[model samples]
Target: MILVAADRVLGRGGALQLQIETVAGDAGVEVDAVRARFPDVLALATAVLRFRQEQWLTGLAAAAVGISEPRDRILALFSYLESCFMDDDWRGCAFINGYGELGRAEPTIAALADEHLASIETHLRALCIEAALPPYVADGLSLLVQGAKVEAAIHGTTQPARSARMTAAMLMSVYEPAREDLFI
Candidate 1:
């Protein structure tokens, strides 16, 4: 239902009440029932946002880290991001969009978005460690991931993913010498 009413939920300056009603109708449920089931709409929306964000992040992590070579892993990650950008249903990062929509109104939603982004950072950090890259490389890659998402969404193009991939390759090259020094 979120996908069905994404325009209403994510579009500029719509009344929350009307958005909820439209979502409820699309979901084939009474608005009152939806309200009864989730009195705190922000919390419910945050949960959905987290779910969607984690889904993509986790999938990307798995695809990246599942490969054997460091360069291959980075390529895998870039490929995944490119595919996401090209997806017909792609509508940007859900957490980012949700935060833009509800962050100021609901602090909990903001916190949830932060937590979700942090989780992605943690996962990327782990991948960096596994790849024997410098610790700070994870942070740079995380920023690249986020920037690519925003750029792709805004421009409706996969160019950002390609650029991010080139950046990641450069970062990996800088840290490649340290690979043998790390215990992991």
Candidate 2:
């Protein structure tokens, strides 16, 4: 409950704004109750960060559930994110924000941020390998995804995801000449 409240708070503002009192109130529990579970704002923030990151990955997996083709599975994940871009409350990725806000002050946040990025890379790489795509496809797709994420967050538009999706298709086609028709 506390972590969910913290995530809601984080969804509204930066990590620094996540307060124990706010969480307690949102969670419908006493401040002491909230404190009993999370001794400090940093600890609460850390838990929420992990929660959101895991939720993101789980949701991505769920998105690709019915997908059979490896390349389609990868595209399905990006399409899931493209749909997320339609959410009005979306404020970019919380893990990335957590790192930007308090990563230097707290090493754990930095480590968790690194872990989340690495997980994303691993997922992309695994999908690319399954698709028999060039190794560079996964690396390039990761870069494009990260770049698109930043742009979408800053500009409050879905164009970044569309551009990233198009560029990813183009990149894959380069390594998969036989599938050029599918790409087009």
Candidate 3:
């Protein structure tokens, strides 16, 4: 275990140390700690943590939003994705790696991801009730959306988004009517 100091701004315009353990021991400590020792350390840490939470929530929301009316669901999905891409640190993006540090540690990104997934599941169930659709159908749609996200991110394309949109369209196409009003 390596002790890395994450500096926090003090009352007198100085800084304090916040020690974090790193996998690469001293080397990692030096690199990660250097950035943390700034005057606005606490603010920097907060920003980083919040960004991580938002990223995790965005992915979860993309699927969970479908539990509402189609318009609202699509709105939620679009809003979250917009936040993600607009983030300053986004580099074509990647998924969170370690879960251990998040919930218990200062950042708590992993916990955010875990909680967001549960929320998504709940949203799907609620949407089903609202749509008067079978509960199992909602469950299936949620699973499909999850799969689409994973595949899209893995392949580094918009295919996942397209697939998810198609799946949602299918769900909304429950009515076999030959009228435009019956289409989603």
Best lDDT among the predictions, by candidate number: 2
Error of 1 at 22 (Å): 1.2
lDDT of each model, Cα atoms only?
0.71, 0.85, 0.46
**In candidate 3, what residue range of length 10 has the lowest lDDT sum?**
3-12
Better of 1 and 2 by TM-score: 2
The residue-by-residue lDDT of candidate 1 on 101-153, one tens digit each, is 67778787788779878976886787687788867788899899889988998
Tens digits of lDDT, candidate 3, 48-85 = 34454464666755555436464346434534444444
Structure candidate 3, residue pairs in collision: 67-127, 102-108
| Candidate number that wins on lDDT, 1 or 3 | 1
lDDT of 2 by residue, 55-120 (tens): 888888898998898888877777877877788877887877889999988999999989988888
Position 84, candidate 1: lDDT? 80
lDDT of 3: 0.46
Best by TM-score: 2
The regions of model 3 sitting more than 4 angstroms off are: 1-111, 175-184
TM-score of 2: 0.92
Superposed Cα deviation of residue 183, candidate 1 (Å): 20
